[model samples]
Structures are given as structure tokens and as C-alpha cells.
Target: MQIFSFKKFLKEQFILLSLSAIVGILSALFIAFFLKLLEAATAYRNSHFQLLFLLPIAGWVIYLSYQYLGKNSSKGNNLIIKEAKGNQESVPAVMLPLVLFGTVITHLFGGSAGREGTAVQIGGTVAAKISEWCKLNQQLRSILLICGIGAGFSAVFGTPLTGFVFSLEVLVIGKMEYKAAPYSLIASLIANYFCLQLGIHHTKYFITSSIPMNGEWISIALKVGIASIGFGLAGYLFSYFIELFKKIYSKILPKAWMIPIFGGIIIIILGQWLVGKDYLGLGVDPNYPGAASIVGAFHAGGSFTWSWFWKLLFTTITLSAGFKGGEVTPLFFIGAALGNTLATLFNIPIDLLAGVGFIAVFAAATNTPLACTMMGIELFGAANLPFFAIGCFVAYYCSGHSGIYTSQNIGIAKNSFLQIRNNKLLSQHLSQKELFYHKKWTLVKNKYL
Candidate 1:
């Protein structure tokens, strides 16, 4: 019996590893192509400048495309999360072209969004198709989906370990799936390697200032802790505003297609007249770098005090307006900008604060402190891992139970004081909380009146 079990284990390991490699390579290739196209689109938009005016038309085309061809593909990243959580529906294959096209158009027309959504969708769709082709069981299919997510994240960001850990951590808040670690690691490394081999390069950030370990260490820690609270609030506000804007849009424009048009017009008005073009699109362009970009946040006088707020507002509007893209990169920009602003006030090195904010905001919004800490080490260096941990974990708790991914399940409630049920989706949890508050307010009103 021992011999038979050993043989079966070897076979299963081999098959799973092989599938992981395939997913990694395919995801990397797709991400590479997507990045190249995205770069070209951004370059064209920068040079033309007039394309910004045609944003409404571009949005209309995107709306029409999805209306005609996208069958549940509009759910975007939520669909993948739902599938990983045992949803009966498979991730639709049409999601790849639809998201890719929609995101590209969004960027081309100066929609302030990020690329992580497109990359993740591509990876999930590919993995789902491969699982269908191989007729894998539900368990195996779910594992592959996790592998796909890691690969896509790794390939796009060039951070394999972060990707590996994020894949395991992101499915359920306050829980990590250690069972998928080896597969996710292998997939992330392979995808990052192949993405680089395909001529794709991720952005680099530096922290030149060394953290002091002397008596000043206490002061620094306190400042970081305080700043982390702000980071968490920024993350909470970002998620809150996006959902609020989405609700407002849906309420005002009952027609699904009209939402994008109205959103496009708002973006144009905001972009051209009020905010300038600094906060539009990805906010990181090699060809036309802005004072309010992620790179700019690293230096003194690089960003205005309110630069982070503008980016946050632009991104929330862009995403809530039915534009397609991920929220992660914009979160990075916002965090970094906020960090820059706070560093001057807190007497910390600007670059160091920016670095922490970059990862901490993402950590708060995603509720993945461990992954963001790893990302900090990967992007900025491990010299300040303690600061990274403090910022990330603090921000995570401060952000509360809210996050950008509403479909994400809460495996463990953040606090026992809250009467949240285990394994409840965040969306459901938020709705319940709102209902509870509403009921309390109604009782108060009746009593007073």
C-alpha cells in the first residue's frame, strides 16, 4: 500500500507541475503582448492629444462591443474570484479579447485606469480554458486558476514571490491557502522569467536613504505608524468612492450604455479644464512623464500635496464610469504621492516614505499585507522590511473589512466584535452592515419623532 501511494503521489505531482509550467508560459506571453500594445496606445495618445476629446466615442464603441459579444465577461476579475470560490460557471473565454480591447481603448482615450485587471483576466481565462480542455476535476481546476493568477501577476509586475503569495492570500481575507504554494511559486517564477525573456521590463523603484537604528528609530516608527493609518484610510476611501460612484452612475443613468458616455464626458471635463491631463490614463509614461506620476513621488518637489487625491478621484471616476482596468497601479500612485506629502511633514526621507506608501496602500486595499511586504522587498529592497511590515499590516487593519474586490470571501472576520459570519462574501457583508446601520437609524428616528 505504501509503494502504491508513493507512485500515485509522484504521478499527481508531475502532472500538476507540468500544467503549472504551461499556464505560466502562456500567461507570460499574453501579458507581454498586452503590455506592448498598451505602451503603443499610451504613446499614440500622448502624441495625438486630441484623442482625449474622442473618449466618449471610444467608450461608446466599447459599450457596443461588450453589449454584443460579452456574455458575463463584464464581471471582469469578480468572475475569476467567484470561480475560484466554487462558482459553477467557468470563466468565459471571451473575457480575454473583450477586456484586452476595452482596456486598450480606455487607455487610448485617456481613461485613468491600470493594467492589472487585463493581465489577471487573461490569465484566468486561459487557465479556465485549459482546465476545460483537459477535463480536470473541480479541485484541480481551482488550483490551476490560482496558478494562473500568480503567473499573470508575476509576469506583469516582475515580482514572482509577491505573486506567489498574493495568489494564495487574495482568495480569502485573513486566510492563506498553503496547499497551493508550491504550484503558485513555480508558476510565478516561470511566468516572470518568460516575460522578461519576451522583452518586457517592469518599473524599478529605489530607496536610497538608510533607516536609522539609533534613538531616532523610535520616532521613525511612530511616524510610519501614523502614516500607515493615513494610508489605510486612503485605501478605504479609494474603495468606498469607487463603489459610491458606481452606485451613483447606475442610479442616475438607468441605461447601461449611457453610463460610459456620461462618465467619458465627466472625465473630459475634469481632465481638460480642472485637473489637467496629469492624472489621466496609467499615470506612468516613459515618453511623457508627469510631475504627479509614481516616479515623481520619489523626489522632493515631485508631487503636489493634493496629487494623491486627484489621482484617487480620477481613478475612481474612470473605473466607476465603466472603464476597464485594474485598480492596483493607481493605488500605487496614490500611496506614493501621499507618502511623499506626508514625508515632508513627518521629517522622513521622501523616497523611503514613498516606497512604503506604494506597497502599503495596495496592501490595505487588497487586504494582503504579507504579499505587499514581499513586494516592497522585491521592488525597493529588504533593508526596510520592518517598516514595510509595519506599514502594510497597520494599513491592512485600518482599512477594515472593505476592499476593492467585493467578491472576495472573508474566511475569518477581522475582529471578533463584529458579528460577521465566516465564508461570507465582502459584498454581502457590506450590505448586511449597511442594513444594520439603516435599521438602527430608523429606530432612532422613530424614537425622536
Candidate 2:
């Protein structure tokens, strides 16, 4: 009986790992296609500036697609997170094609967005199908979802370890669930390998500056920590404005169709008339002469002071207006650009500061310091890991309780003193906290009177 049970356990483990590999391969293929599509669309948009004017039309098509076929798929990343948490039963298969098409359209029309959402949605949707086909139990299903997320992220960015931790850290705040760690790792590794096999190369960032931890490390830490607050605030503003614009547009426009059209018009006016198109599309490469891209921010004279804000503004409006893409890559561009400006002010190495901001702002926005730290090590090297950890953690705390994903629950409150409810969504917690303040302040004012 003991031998029989051992054999059964081994067989089950083999089957799970095999399934994980399958998910990873499928995720890699999907993400590869998504990345290629993004590149082509971006290239087309850059060459044909006339396409910028058709953003409203593109937005209308996106809106109609989701309105008709999206169902709960419109929730995007939030839906995937909820499903991973077992709060949702399944992720829709349509999410795979819808987000792929929507994100491609978004970039083709020059919407400032990222690809992580499309990749993540593809992974989750694929995993949902696998779960049904394999008849996985709830626990196994959750693991499968993690594998998918990890695979897609790793495949897209070529960071397997970061993808593993991000899959664990991103679903819930202040908790790292490792139940699916092994599967996630396997999926991330296999997916990254598959993407590489398809000749999909991720962006490379190098930090050649020596960060000494002797006499000057303390001051360096202080400066990086202080600057990280700015990064955090940038993240806060991004999240705040996205929610604000959504409310403002929904209240004023009411019709979902008009919201994107007006937003597209504003984007066109802002991109062409005022800001000069530096902030449009994925700011990863220089579109025009001396344009600030993520790569450009690493070198001297790479970015202007206001570049970060413009990217933030563009991304906030683009996403709030119902554009389909991820926020992470744009956040990376914003963070790196802001770091360049902060480097000028703080007298730090420009590349170092840019690297810090690159990971720090993403950590702040996503509430995943550890994952971002890992990402820093992956993208840049491990030379400045101490500083990376410092920037990520500080930014994480300073970014406030809110994040881009409203469905994220407070598994553990950031502050023990605060009365944050356990397992409640951040959006709900914010509402409850707001009501509490209103009643408390009202009663206090009444007593004073």
C-alpha cells in the first residue's frame, strides 16, 4: 500500500508538471504573438501619424467589441487576480482574443499603454481552459492560474524569477503565497525559453556604476529613499487620476461611446499641440529626435523634467478612456524618466537613478516590492540590490493603500495601527475608511458647535 501510494504521488506530480509546461508553452506562444503585434502596430503608428486622428474611431471599435463580446472580460487584470484568489470560478476564453485585439488596436492608434495586461489575460484565459480540460481541483486550478500568469509575464519580459514572485505577490497585498511556487517557477522558466526560441528578445538595461556601501552608502540610501517617495507619489497620482478620469468621464459622458472619442480628441490635442508627441505610444524607444524613451533615460540628457508627468497624464487618460493595454511598461517609462530628473537634482549617477525609478515606481503602483526588486536584479544586475530593495520598499509604503488593481485585497494591512479589514478589497476598504472619516469628522464638528 505504501509503494502504491508513493507511485501515485509521483505520477500526480509528473502530470501536474507536464500540464504546467503545456500552459507555459501556450502562454509563450500567445505572448510572442502579442509582442510582435505590438511592435508592428507601434511601427505603423509612428510611420503614419495620420492614424493618430483615428484614435476615437479605434476607441469606438474597442468599446463596441467589449460591450458585445467582453462580458466579465472587460475587468482585465482584476478578473485574473480574482480568479487566482478563487473569488471567481473561471476566466473567460474570449478574454484571450479580446485583449489581444484590443491592445493591438490601442497601440496602432497610438494609445499610451503597456502589454502586460494582454499577456496576463492570455495566460489566465489559457489556464482556465486547461483547468476544465484536466478537471483540476480548486487547489490545482489556482496553481494552474499562477503558472499561467508567471509564464505569460516571464515570456513577455524574459524574467522568469521576477515573474514567479510577481505571480505570488501581485494577487494580494502584503502576502506572498508560495503554494504554487514550484509550478510557477517551472512555467516561468519554460515560457521564457519558448519565447527565446521564437526570437522574442526583451529589453536590456545595464548599470555600470559602482555603488559603494562604505562611507557614502548611508547618504546614498537616504537620497534614494527620498527620491523613491517621489516615485511612489507618481504612482499614486497615476492610480488616482485613472479613477478620477473614469468617474469624470462616466458622469459627464454617460455614454461609453462618447467617453473614448472625447478622450481620444484630448489625447490628440495634447500629443500634437502641447506636449509634442514625446509621451505617446510605448515610450520605450525614441520616436522623434531626442524623444524620451525608457532606454533613452539611461544616458545623459535622456529626459526632461516634465517627461514623467506627461507620460503619466497620457497613460491615465488613455487607459481611463477604455484603451486596452497594461499600465506596467508605461509606469516603467514614467519611473525611469522621473529618476533621470531626480538624478539631476540629487547628484546621483543618472543610470543608477533611472534604474532605481524603473523598478521603484512599478513596485509602488503594484504594491509588490519584492517582485519589483527581483525584476530590478533581472533587468539590471545585482550590484545595486540593496538600493533596489530600499527603493522598492520605500516606494511601496509611500504609494498609499491604493493600487492600479482595485480587486486586490489587503491580506495584511501595510500599517498594523490602522483599522484595515482583513480580506476586503482595497476599493472597499477605501470606501469604508472614507465613510468612517465622514462620520467621525461630522460628529466632532457637531460637538464643537
lDDT for each of the candidates? 0.90, 0.90
What's the TM for model 1?
0.97
TM-scores across all candidates? 0.97, 0.95
Stretches > 4 Å off in candidate 1? 1-4, 286-290, 444-449
Candidate 2 residue lDDT tens string, 302-402: 88888999999999999999999999999999999999999989988999999999999999999999999999999998989988999999999998898
RMSD of 1: 1.7
Candidate 2 Cα lDDT to native = 0.90
Worst 10 residues of 1 by lDDT: 283-292
